[model samples]
Target: MNDMRMSPNLALNQLVAQRRAAGESLVHLGFGESRLPPFAPLMERLAAGATRNAYGPVAGSPEVRAAVAGYFGRRNIPTGADQIVVAPGSKPLLMALGLVVPGDVILPRPAWNTYAPQARLAGKHPIAVAIPEECGGVPDPAALRESITAARVLGRDPRILILTLPDNPTGTLAPPALIRELCAIAEEEGLLIVSDEIYRDVVHDPATEFLSPAEVAPASTVVVTGLSKSLALGGWRIGAARFPHGPWGEWIRSGVVSVASEVWSTLAAPMQSVAEYAFGEPEDIRERLRASARLHGAVAREVHRITIAAGARCRPPTGAFYVYPDFEPVRAELGKYEVTDSPTLARRMLDLGIVVLAGHLLGDEGEALRFKCATSMLYGETVEEQQLALDAPDPLALAHVRSLLERVEEGFMRLVP
Candidate 1:
C-alpha cells in the first residue's frame, strides 16, 4: 500500500505536459482525454446551480437521480432514483463497490488499470482472466469458469467481476453474444458483475449494437459510467451508477452510500445540476454527443490505419478513441533498439518523441511486446483547433489533425523499420 505507483496514464499525461512546456514537440498518444470543449449548455447549467451550496443526500439529489434514472430508462434499463448514486467521478464509485463487495475480484487480463488497484485497496485478490480473442472488456467464458475454480482451489475467494464496455486501452466493444455468454457464466457462479460503460456513447458507428450485462443479468450486475470519457467533463467530475433493482442491489447501494458518506459526502451541488441536465440527454446534448463520437471515431480510425500500415496487428477502432497494437510481430527487428518488452518499447517511443502507454501498465504481461495508443490526444493543443476538428465533415482532412496523424504514422514507421 505504501509503494504502489501512480496510475500510468495520468503519470504519462503529466510527463508529456511537462516536456511540452519545456519546448519539446512530441506526439502524445498516451492519454484518453477527449480534446473537445464543453458544450455551452453544460457550463450554463453549472453556473445556474452555483447558488446551491448546502450538502445534499449521500446518494445524490433526488432530482439528479431521477434524471439519471430516466437516462437509463430510455436505454431500456428500468432504473429508480433510489438505485442511483452520483459521485465525483465513476472511479470512486467503482472503488467504493470494491470496498463493499465481499470476496476477491475477477478482472480481464488487460483491463482498465484502476480495477486491479481498487480491488487490492479493498483487501481482495484480483483474479486475471483472459479476454476473448475477438474483443476486449468481457472475460472469455471458458477461461472465466476455469479461473474461478482455480482461484477457489487455491483458497482465494473470487467474488466480483469487473468489465469494461468499449474497453480502455483496447477500444473494442464486446459483441452481444459474447456478453450474454459471460453473463450466463456469472449467473451460474453467483458473481457480482460491475460493468464499466464509460465509453458506451462513444461508439464509432451509429449502427453498432451494444448489450449491457445489466440487461441480461439484471439481478446481479451494477452498471457504472461517467461524463469524463463521453461528455468531455473530466475536470467537472460528474459520474453516475445504476444498481440492480432488488434487495441485493439495495444492500450494495446502502453499503456504497455509507462509504460515500465517509468519503465524498455528496456530489458537489453545481455538478449535480450539470449531471441532471447532461444525463437527461436532451436533443441539443444528443447532437453534441453524436458530433463528438464522429470526431473520435474519425481520428481513431485514421490512427488504426497508420498502425496497420506500419505492420502492427492492430484492431479496428469500433467504440472508443484507442487502438491496442501488439508489436510482437516485429520483436526480432526491434532487438537492435533494445526493445524486448512493453516498458522498453514504450521507452523507445518516448525517446523518439512519441508517447505511448506500455501494455504492461494496463496489466498485460511485462514481457509482452504490446502497447496502447490513445488517438483522442491527436485532436489539437488549443480549444479553437479542437472545435474546428469537431465541426469539420472530415476531421482528418483538417491540417492540424492531419499533421498529428502524420506524426504518429512517421513515428510508427521509424519504430517498425
Candidate 2:
C-alpha cells in the first residue's frame, strides 16, 4: 500500500480537473472514462429504488443477478443466476478474483493499468507479454507460450491470464481466431482466464467480431462487466460477473462472494436497482450504447489521423475511444524539442496544452515514444451538447467537438513539424 500511488488514469483525471478548474485551457486525452451523461431511465431506476434501503445480498440481489444472467443468455452464453455476482464496481470484483485465484498473473504488455496492481496486491507476480501486432488486449499467442515456459523455468507459477475485449489505450479488439488460440494455450497449461468485457458494447462498428474466452474455454474462464462504460454509469458503481458452470466455477464464485461480503458488502441498494434495469438491455439502453459508440468512433478516428499526419504510427481504432500512437518514427524530430522517451514525449505534449497518458504508464518500455490518447473527453462539455453529439448524424460536425479536435491537430502540428 505504501509503495503504490494512485492509479495513473485516476491521477491524470484529477490533474486535468485541477488544471481546468484553475482556468487552464488544455485538451485532456489521458483518462479512459466513458464521458457521457447517464440515461434517464437508469437514473429513474436509482431514484425509484431510493426508498428501499438495505444491504441486500453480498453477491447482489437475486433479481439483479438474474438480470445479468439474462444479459449473457441473450448474448449466446448460457448463464444461471447462481453463477452471477454483483458488486459496487468491477474493480473490487476483480480484486476479489485476484485474491482467490492462485499463482502469478500474465498480462498483455499494455493492459489496463489496474491489472498489474491488482496482481501485486494479491501477492502474485505479473508477467508482461507484448500483444500481437494486430491488437492490444490479448497477448501474442506464440509469445504467450514462450513467456509461460520462461517463467516456469525460472521457478515461477503462472496460473492465470487476463484479457480485455475492445481494449483501453489501444481501442482495438482481438479477432476470434486469436482468442481461440489463446484459449487453447490456457487449456494446455491449465490456466484460469479472466475476461474483462466492460468495453464489449463500446465497439464502434456493430459488425466487428468479438469472441469471449468463456465461449472457447468455458470451464476455465470468468467474465466481469459493468454499466460504467455501457450506460455511462461510472459513478453509480454497479458491476456484475458471470462464472462458469460445474464444481470449479462454483468454488471460485463462492470465494469472490466471500470476499465481497467482507469488502463492499453489496453493490448499493439503489445501484442494484440501476443494474437490474440497465442489464435488462431495454431498447432505449441499446440505442444509447449505439449512439455513444458512433460518437466515440468519430472522435477517435480523427485523433488517429492527427497522429499519422504528425508522423506518428498508430493503430486504427475500431472500438472504445482511445488510440495508442508511437512517436518513435519521429524520435529524431522530437529530439529537436527535447522529447526522447515516453515520459518526456508525454510531457512535451502536455507542455503544448494537450495531456496524454504516456505509454510507459501502461507497462510499455519507458524509452519508447508512445502514449494513450483518449477521445471520449472531446465530446461536448455540457449534457446538452453531449445529447446533441449523441443525436447528431456526425458528431464531428458539431462546432464544439470540431474545435477541440482542431485544438489537438494544431497542437500536434506545432510540435511535430
Candidate 3:
C-alpha cells in the first residue's frame, strides 16, 4: 500500500488547491470533477434523512437498491434489487471487483488513472492495449485477441476487461458498432466486463448513440455508476453497481457485499436517502442533469477547438468534460523549451498558469507528449458563478468562462510559438 501513490487526479487536485492557497493564478484543468453547484432538492433530501443515522444494510438499504435497480432498468439493462449493491463510491466497488474477480485485468492503454493501480493493489496484473483512434475507453478490437494471448504466454491470467463509456482522459464516447465489436471479443475470450458508465449521463449531444456493454452483453457485464460525475455529488460518495442476473452474478455480488461489510460498512445513511432521491430520476433532478450536461459539452468543445488551433491533436470531446491532447505535432517547437514528454509538457503548462494531468499518469507511455486537460473545471470558481454559467445561453462566451479558455489557448500557443 505504501508503494502505491495517490490517485493521479486527486493528487493533481490537491496540488492545484495548494498553489491557489499560495495566491497563484492557475487555470485548473487537472481534475475531472464536475464543477457545478449541487442541486437544492438533493440537499434537502440529505438534510431530511440526517436524523436516520444507524447502520443500514451492507449491500445498501432496500429502497436505494431498488431505486438503483430501476435506474438500470430504464437504460434497457433489466435489473432487480438483489442484483444491486450501493457503495460509498464507485472506486470501492471497482476495487472490490478487482479483488474478487479472478486473474489480471485488460485495460485500454491510457485509461482512467485508477484502474491499473487498483489492479496492482488487488494482486493482479493490468494488461493495457491501445485504444481505437476514435475513442479512449475500450481496447482496439484488432489488438484485443493478440494482447490476451501475449499476456497468457507471459504467465498472466487475463479474466476481466474494464471499459469506460464516454471515457475519462479522452472524453469521447465509443460508437455502438465499436461497443458491439468489443463485446464480441469479450464473449469470445470468456472475459467478464466491468463497464464503468459513470459518465453516461454527460453525453454532449442528446442524439448521440451511447451504448453500454450491459445492454449488448448483459450476461457477463457489471455496470457501475454513481452520482459523482452526473449530479455534482462527488463528495457525497454515492455509487451503485448492477450485476448480471444469474448464479455467477449472485456469487460476485455476495463477494462484493462481504468486502463492503468489512470496509465501508454501508453507504452512509444520509447518502442513501440522497441516492434514493437521485436515482429515482425525478423531473427536477433530470432537468438539473440535462443543464449540467449542456454546460459541460459547450466548455469541452471550446477547449477542444483551442487545443487543435494551437497545433495539438485532440479528439473533439463528445461527452464528459476532458480533452486528451497530443503535443507531438508541436514537438519541435516544444523541444526548444525542453518539453519532450508528457510530464515536461504538463510542467511547462503549469509554469504558464495552466494545470493538466500528464498522459503518463493515466498509464500512457512515458515518452508520449500528451496530457489530459479537464474542461469541467473551467466553468467557474464559485457556486454562484457556476450556476450563472449553467443558466447562460452561451456559457463559453461569458467573461469568467472565456478567460479560462483563453488561458488554455495562450498557454498552448506559448508552447508552439
Candidate 4:
C-alpha cells in the first residue's frame, strides 16, 4: 500500500540508521523502545515451545486466548477466550478493525500516525480533531462534537474514534473523567471507540486511575493492548484485542479472524507460548510490569525536566517513556539558525549528534518546532546498568542514567541557545 501512511517511529529509525551510516555520533531518542530486559520465564517458555511446526488457528491458540481472558479479568474488565484475537501486532489488529468498522475514522490531531492511515487503507476518511489541553490522546469532547457536525455537513460519516492512553509522543494519559466524557459523546454519536491502551500498564503513578473506554462504554468500545512496550517485546510481535460481549462482538471477532487468515495466518508458536505466559496474569508478570513502569516513569520525568529547563514547552509526563517538547519558546533563537520548522529542528538535532522524531511525524502541524523524545533509549549499553538502575534505592541517583540525562540536558541547551 504505497498510498498508505508509514509509521513515524519506523521512519525515524530509518533516519537514525542513515545518520549512523554517515558516521554521526547520534544520541538516539527516536524510536520509543523499552530497553529493559525481558522476563526470563517468558524466554524459557518460548524456548520450550520453539519446536512446534504446524500453524495453529487463525484467531490464536486456545491457551493464549484463555490467558488473555484471564489477564483482562484481573484488570476488572470481564472478557472470554472468544472475545480475544491475538495478532502479529496491535498495529495489524487496529488495521483490521478499521476495515471491519464502517465510516470515517476520528483521531486526535497529534496522535500515533498509523491510526489515520490504517483507516484510509480501509477506504475510510480520517478526520483529525484537536485534543484537550490536559491529555494528548483522546480528542476533546467539545471538539469531537463540532468535528462530527462539520464532517456530517460535508457528507462524511464519522463512525470510529481512536484513543491512545499514555500516548506515544506526548506520554500523558487521559484522565478517567475525560475518558468517561468522550465515551458519552461516542455513545451519542453511535461511534465505535478503539482504545489503544498499549501503555496503560506503564503508569508512573500507581494512584493515577485508568478507566478503559470499554469500562465506560462497553457497548461500542474495543480495547487493544500488547506486550511490546511494557515488556520490551516489540521484536516478538505478539498483541491482542478485547471486544465487547454481544452479536456485534462476534461479528467483529469473526472479521478480525477472517483478515488474519488472509494475512499473518497465525502468530509464531514460540511467540504464542510467550503470549500465554504473559497473558496468564502470574505474580512474576505482575512484578515485571511494576518494575518496568517504575523505570519508564522515572526516566521519562527526567527528560521532561531537562527539556523544560532548556526553555522548551512540554506537559508533565504521566506515563510511557516519552516527552513532546515544543521549541517555540526559543523560536527567535531557532530562526537565527534557520530552524523554523519541525523538520529543520530535527535535522539540527541530528547535526548536534542527537536524534528525535519531529512533531509533524505524529500528525501535528509540520511547521511547529516540536518533537518527541523517547527516554527509554537512554538505558546504558548493558543489562547490568539497566538492572542496577531498576533495583537501585533511587534510580535517579544511579550514575549511568544520570549521565545520559546530563547529556540530553546539555544537548537541548546547546540546541536552544
Candidate 5:
C-alpha cells in the first residue's frame, strides 16, 4: 500500500529545487498554484475574523455552510446549508468521501494521482477506465459501461465514479452532453458520482456551458469544490462538498462527518470566516474571480500555442493551468538523446532547466513521452506584482510572466530540435 502511493508533482518540485539550488537556470512549470494574490477585501475579511479561535462544528459553521449553499445556488444548483460540508482542503474531504462510499472506485486513467491512492487508502479497489480523447477526467460513456461490465464479470464491485470537470493534468473540460450521458449511466447502474469541480470557475470561455452532475443526477452525486484553484487561496485550506438529497445521501454524509470528527475534527475558524465571505455572492468577489479567469485563460492559451508549435500534440486547454503535451511526434529526435520514456523526458526537461511532471506520473503509459506543464507558475514572484498583473489592462504581457513564457518556448524547442 505504501509503495502504491506516490506524488509525481512533489518529486518534480524537489528536482526543480535541487537544480535551482545548484544555480541551474530552471524554468518551473510543475506545481499548479494561482500566480494571483488573494483579493484585498477577502484578506481584510480574514484579518477581521482572526480572533475566531474556537474549533467550529465538524461540518462547519451555519453561516459558512449557508454561504457555500448560496454559492452553488447562484450557479443553478438548488442546494441548502444542510447539504454543505466544509473542510480544511478538498483533498481530505475527497478522502472522506472515498471512505464513506462503498464499492470499488472508478477512476479515469491519466487522472490526478491521488484519486487512485485515495481509493486504495479507503480499502477499496480502484478500477481505471480510459478517458475519451476529448476529456481527461470522465471515461467515455461507452468505455465506462464496458469497463463496469468487465469489472463485475471479474467479481469486482465498481460502484463509485470520480470525475474532474476541468481536469488537472490535461486541463480539458468535459462537454455537457457527455456529462449528461455519464449521469444517465450512473443512474442506471446505481453508481455514486463524485464530481470534482475545483477548476470550474477558472474555465476559459464565459460562453462555455457547464452541466454539474448535481443538476443532472442529484440523487447520487456529490460535487466537490474549493478555493484552492480559483482564489489562489491554497494555503487557506477551505473546501466544500455538496451531498445529494436521499436516505443514502444522509448515510454517506454521516459517515463523512464521523470520519471528519476523528481525522481533521473541523475546519479552522478563521478559514471558515474566509469561506463565509468568499462564498457569498458579493460583487467585489465576483469581479476578482472574473479577472483571475481572464488572466489564467490568456496565459494557458499562450502556453498551449507554444507547446503545439514545438511539435508536440496538446489539446487546447479550456480550464485550469495545465497543458499535457504528447511528444510522440518528436520521439525519434528525443530517442537520439537517450530520452525514450516519460521519466527520461521529465528528467531531460529538468536538465534543460524546465520543471514539468511526467505523464507517467499521472498514470499515462511510461513509454508515451508525455508530460503535464503547469503554466500558472509563470507569474511574478512578489504579491504586489501579482496583484498589479491581476488588474493590469493587458495582463498577458506582464514582464515577468512573458519572460517565463519565453523560457518555456525556448525549452520545448530545445527538446525537439
Candidate 6:
C-alpha cells in the first residue's frame, strides 16, 4: 500500500503543471482529460440547482436516475430508474464495484491505471490478461480462459471481470464479435462483468459497431457511464450505473448504495441536475457530443500519423482521444539514447518537452518501449483557445492548434533522430 504512487495520469498532470509554472515549455500529452469547455445549458442547469442544496437519495435523484435509464434504454439496453445508481463520478462507482463484488478481479492488461489499484484497495487480487491485437478494453478471449484457470489453480477466486469500451490509454473500441466472444466466456466461467463505458459517447465513428457487454450478457453485466468525457464535466463529478434487473442486480445495487452511504453519501445536488440534463440526450447536448467526437477523432488521428511516421507502431485510434504508441520498432535507434524501456522512453520524451504516461504505469510491461499519448491536451493551454479549436471549421488547420500539433510532431521526431 505504501508503495503505490498516485494515479499516473493525475500525477503526470501535476508534474506538468509544476514544470510549466517553473517556465518549462512542456507539451502535455499525459492526462486523459477532455480539454473542451463545458456546455452552456448545462452550466445554467447547475446554477438553477445551486440553491436546492440538500442530501439526495443514496442511489440518486429520481429525475436524474430516470434520465440515465433512458440513456441506456435508447442504446438497446432495457433499463429502469430503479436499476440506476448515481455517484460522484464513475471512478467511485467502479471502486465500489470492486469492494462489493466477490472474488479476485480480472483486468485487461494495459488498462486504465485506476482499475488494478481500485481492486487492491478493495482487498481483491487483480488478474491482468493481455488485450487482443484488434482492439483494447476487453481481454484477449483466448488468454482470458487460461488466466482464469491459472488464478483458480493458485486458489484465487476469480469472479469479477472489468472491461472498458473505447478504452483509456489505447482509445480503441472492441469489436462486437469480440464482445460477444468475451461475453460467452464470462457466462461459461460464471463471472460477473463490470463494464466501464465512460467513453461510449465519445466513439470517433458513429457508424462503427459498438457493443456493450451489458447488451450481450445483461444477466451478468453491470454498465457504468458518466458525463465527464462527452460533456467535459469532469469537475462536476456526475456518474451513473445501470444494474441488471433481478435479485442479483438488486443485491449488487444495495451493496453499492451501502458503500456509497458510508463513502460519498450521494452525488452532489447540483451535479445531479447536470446529469439529468445531459443524460436525457437533449438535442443541444447531442450536437455538442457529435462535434466533440469529431474533434477528438481528428486530433487523435493526426497524432497517430505522426507516431507512425516517427517509426513507432501505433494502432489507428478508433475512439476516444488516445494513442498507445509502441516504440519497439525503433529499439535500436532509441538504444542510442539509452531508452531501452517504457520508463526510459517516457523520460526521454519529457526531456524533449513532451509529457506522456509510460505504458508500464497502465500495466504494460516495463521492458516495452511504449507510452499513452493523450491528444485531447493538445487543443490549447487556455479555455478560450480550446473553444476556438472546438469551433474551427478545420481544427487541425487553426494556427494555434497547428502549432501545438507541430510541437508534438517535433517531439516525436526527436525520439527517432
> What lDDT score goes with residue 85 in model 4?
90
Q: State the lDDT of candidate 6 residue by residue for 1-417, as single tens digits.
A: 533778878888888889999999989988888998898999999999898789889999899999999999999998989999999999999999888988999999899999999889888998999999888888999899999999999999999999999899899999999999999999999999999999998999889888899989999999989988888888888889899889999999999999999999999998888888999998999999999999999999999999999999888999988999998898999999999999999999999999999999999999999899989998887889999988877899988999999999998998888
Better of 3 and 5 by TM-score: 3
After superposition, which runs of candidate 5 have C-alpha atoms over 4 Å from their true positions? 1-6
Among the numbered candidates, top lDDT falls to 6
State the lDDT of candidate 5 residue by residue for 302-356, as single tens digits. Answer: 9899988989888889998888888898889899999999999988987777888
For candidate 3, what is the total of clashing residue pairs? Answer: 0
Please, what are the lDDT tens digits per residue for candidate 2 over residues 217-267? 999999999988877778888888999899999999999999988877888
Reference-based TM-score, model 6: 0.99
In model 6, what lDDT does residue 334 have?
95
Backbone clashes (count) for model 5: 0
Q: All candidates' TM-scores?
A: 0.98, 0.98, 0.98, 0.96, 0.97, 0.99
Error of 1 at 312 (Å): 0.6
Q: What C-alpha lDDT values do all the predictions have?
A: 0.90, 0.90, 0.91, 0.87, 0.87, 0.92
Better of 3 and 4 by lDDT: 3
> Where in model 3 is the C-alpha error above 4 Å?
none
Per-residue alpha-carbon lDDT of candidate 3 for residues 1-417, written as tens digits (9 for 90 to 100): 543778878888889889999999998888889998889999999999999879988999899999999988888888899999999999999999998889999999899989998999999998999998889898999899999999999999999999998899899999999999999999999999999999999998889988899989988999999999999899999989999899988989999998998889999999999999999999998888889899999999888888999898998899988999898888898899999888899999999999989999988999999999888898888998899999998998899988877887898788777
Candidate 5: Cα lDDT at 19: 72
Off by over 4 Å in 1: 1-3
